[model samples]
Each structure stands twice: as C-alpha cells, then as structure tokens.
Target: MDLASYAELAIELVNSSDPAEDSLRDLDSLQRLLRIRPHLGGRVTRRDLDAMRELRDSLRAVFTAAARGDHADAVDRLNTLLIQHPVQPQLSGHDGQCWHLHLTESGSVPDRYAAGAAMGLAVLISDRGVDRLGVCAAEGCGNVFFDTTVDRSRRHCSPQCAGRSNGIP
Candidate 1:
C-alpha cells in the first residue's frame, strides 16, 4: 500500500487549498506542486487546475467526516472517490530504487492525483482506522492532515499552527 508515500500525496493536495487561502490559484502553482511530486506530473492546463481544486475539496470532506466521528460518511465519500478515480496498483522502481507499490492511472494530472490520493486515503483508513484522518484543530485553520502520531493526538496540521495555537510565537 505504500501508505506513507501515497498518503503524503493526499495530505499535500488537501493542504494546498485551505479555507483562508488556496495555494493552487493558477496553472503555475499546480505545476509547481506536481514538480514537487513527480509521480503526478503532466502537462497541466486550466481545466486541470479547476479539477484539482475540486479534488481538494472532496478530499477535505473525508478528513472532516473522520474528525466528526462519522465513519460511515467518510467511507462513503472515499468510496465515491475510488469509483471516480479508479487507481490501478503497479510496481515500479523509477529512480533505480527497489521495486515498490505505485498507484498509476491514465488521465490528466488532476485525474492521476485524484486516483492516487483517493486510493491512499482508502487504504490508510481501512488499515489504520478512520480516526487517522483529521482536520487541524487550531482556530481558523481548516487544512486537513493524516495523523501519524503514535498516540493519534495530532491536533494541528503543522508545527507552526500548533505553536500559534499554544501562543508560543
């Protein structure tokens, strides 16, 4: 399931767009994100940017549902994404590395991102538990995150948010 790899992709995608501001405001921003994660690289377009924004919202809903203790809703939302994206598992050693699982798809950049992110979240929820998905608990920050803490006590999306919430800076 290459959980960390794919799950981080999902988290990055969701975090790129937040209630306060959207990092993916143009084709250039979207391309930059894809450059950061070459697995989802492609010739992006305006349509792709629009689609990615939509995908961000959909993925955020899954985290929101999980945070609310609505497992059924979270599962349902993820299921819809899986059906829409339909990722195919494959093994690839793309950079002269050992063979590892990779979720591949044939479509636009947004489509590929959607497939990988949806499949990753689905596997993560089933293997670790839905509670592993979460929304930032810091006030005014709606970024979503995949909790990796041993105690599952993650409350903010990042250390900066945590510090701000604690009045540490």
Candidate 2:
C-alpha cells in the first residue's frame, strides 16, 4: 500500500484506548496489518517493540496535528523523525516486487519498522498533502485515523470504536 494507506492503518493500530482482555490481542492484530510487507520489518526483539511503541507515539502526534489542520506542524514532526533515522530507498528481492523502496538500512526490526512508517508518512505528506490525516470524533476517545474513505468522512479509528462511542450496544 501507499503512504496514505499505510498511514491510515498506522493510526488504527495505535489509537485504541481499550484495556480489556482482548486489547493486547487487538494490538497484535493491528501490528500484523502494519507489518504486512515484510520489508517493514516484523517483531523480532525488545528493542523492536520499543521502537514500534515510539513510532506509535510519533504517529499519534502526526495524526493529532493533522486533525487540527496543522500541516506545518505535522510535517515538522515527520522531518524530525526522519532526521533521527534517515531512510535510503534500496531495491532488493525479485518476486516481481520490483525494487520497492525501504525505509531503513539493514538493522534492527524496530529501526526498519520506524523507517518504513516514516517513509510512508513522507510519501503521504509529499503527494496527497497532510490534510488527509484525521482523528476520531468519538467523545472521550481521541484516537487518530487516516481519511482513506472515498467520501473522506472517516470519524472513528475503527468500526467497533465508532459503534461503542455512539452507544450502539
């Protein structure tokens, strides 16, 4: 998926506030989605997990800024992240994947994941602009979301979250 798609998925992965029995499971599911492309790196170590957590926080900030229509701020935040961990696009493998860019150099899983996400966000901001990012409107749940829907009316990070917020027991 492109940056826009990845960004949306990233938002969904981190914004959940649920602390129930299934919350960790839900998080794991979301992480799988984010790491769909093996190039983004999969869970491999404690440092990787920590890096993912940091990326989650950074992504949250990006989305929150976007929700407020703060494009400059969001871009600045992305830039800072990029500086800390620069990305160099490289071509590898030959399964007709055809030289898709990678976000990080060969290193830790977390570094790879963070680089991939940063690269995705960079693409999103550069191509579609940062206005596409958003936050869930559900009261008391400030989860962030990416507006990938055709109508761009996405309010909640997930359907379940949306339903719960709406009192749709």
Candidate 3:
C-alpha cells in the first residue's frame, strides 16, 4: 500500500469519533473501517475496537499538536506511538501493480493498524513538515486533515464542510 494512503488511515481513525458521536461505536463499525482499508485486516473483536478508540485519541492529539504549531509535541507523540507499535517494513506488490513498501502483516489487528498509521504520520511529518497536518476550521467540525494544497491554505476537512461553514446549503 502507498505510505500516504496509510497516513490516511491515521486521519480516518482520528475523524472516526468526536465529542458529538463515534463511528467506531461497535464491532460492525470497526469492520466497516477495515473493509475500506483492506491492507489492515485481521480477526478483529470488541477488544480491538476499544484499542482502536484509544489509538484514535492518541493520534488526534498528535494532529492537534501539529496543526497548532507545536511541532515538538507532535513529533514526541508520533515517536511514542512508533515505539509502542513498531512496524516491520517490506516490499510488496500484487494485482499487477508495481512493487512498493508495506508494513508487515503481523501482530494483532489493532497493533498492525497502529503501526501503519503511526509510521505513516511520522513519515509525512518528516517529509513535508508538521504544518501539513491540520484540523478543520469549520465550526463544530473538528475533523483532522492532511493538507495537500500547494499553498498549504487548506482550512476545512472537506468541500462539504467549507460549504456548510459558508452557509451554502
């Protein structure tokens, strides 16, 4: 899988829940997330769901710190997670695609997921700077985002949020 796509796993996990509601509220929700991220699949259970929730909170803090200009805190958080959930890198290719780097398919479902997400975030921060990580500016919509804009002016998580913030709907 693409490393950047793995970074998206981190963003998705952080956005999965907020003060208003939680998408990963049950095993089915967790399964749904896994379905989208086929690279991170295993025999998940309720325990894994709880673990993922905890990981989500941890990742959110990282993004929050980065988006707020606390680069040290963000790096520290990613480092801690990297240490906690080490990933083994390997080259893989299938479906007639070119060979690329991928994290090992070992460990429990949560661990594997955490490893990829944390590693992806770490790589992104190191490569593009922590400012690329941001939280949505839309009111009451605090979803995190990996800003890929040329000018780095992305403020909202999605165009829908931007429109909603601008009263377009």
Give the candidate number with the greatest TM-score. 3
- Candidate 3's residue-wise lDDT over 3-79, tens digit each? 76688889989998865657688888788888877777777888898899999999999989988899899999999
Q: What is the C-alpha local distance difference test score of candidate 3?
A: 0.88
**What are the runs in model 1 whose C-alpha is more than 4 Å off?**
18-21
Clashing pairs in 3: none
Alpha carbon deviation, residue 4, candidate 2 (Å): 4.9
Query: Residue-wise lDDT of candidate 1 within 65-141, one digit each (tens)?
Result: 99999989999999999999887778888778888887874677888788888887877877889998989988888
By lDDT, the best candidate is 3
lDDT of each: 0.83, 0.65, 0.88
Give the better candidate number (1 or 3) by TM-score: 3
As a whole number from 0 to 100, the lDDT of residue 74 in candidate 3 is 91
Q: What TM-score, computed on C-alpha atoms, does each candidate reach?
A: 0.91, 0.72, 0.92
Model 2, C-alpha of 53: deviation from truth (Å): 1.8
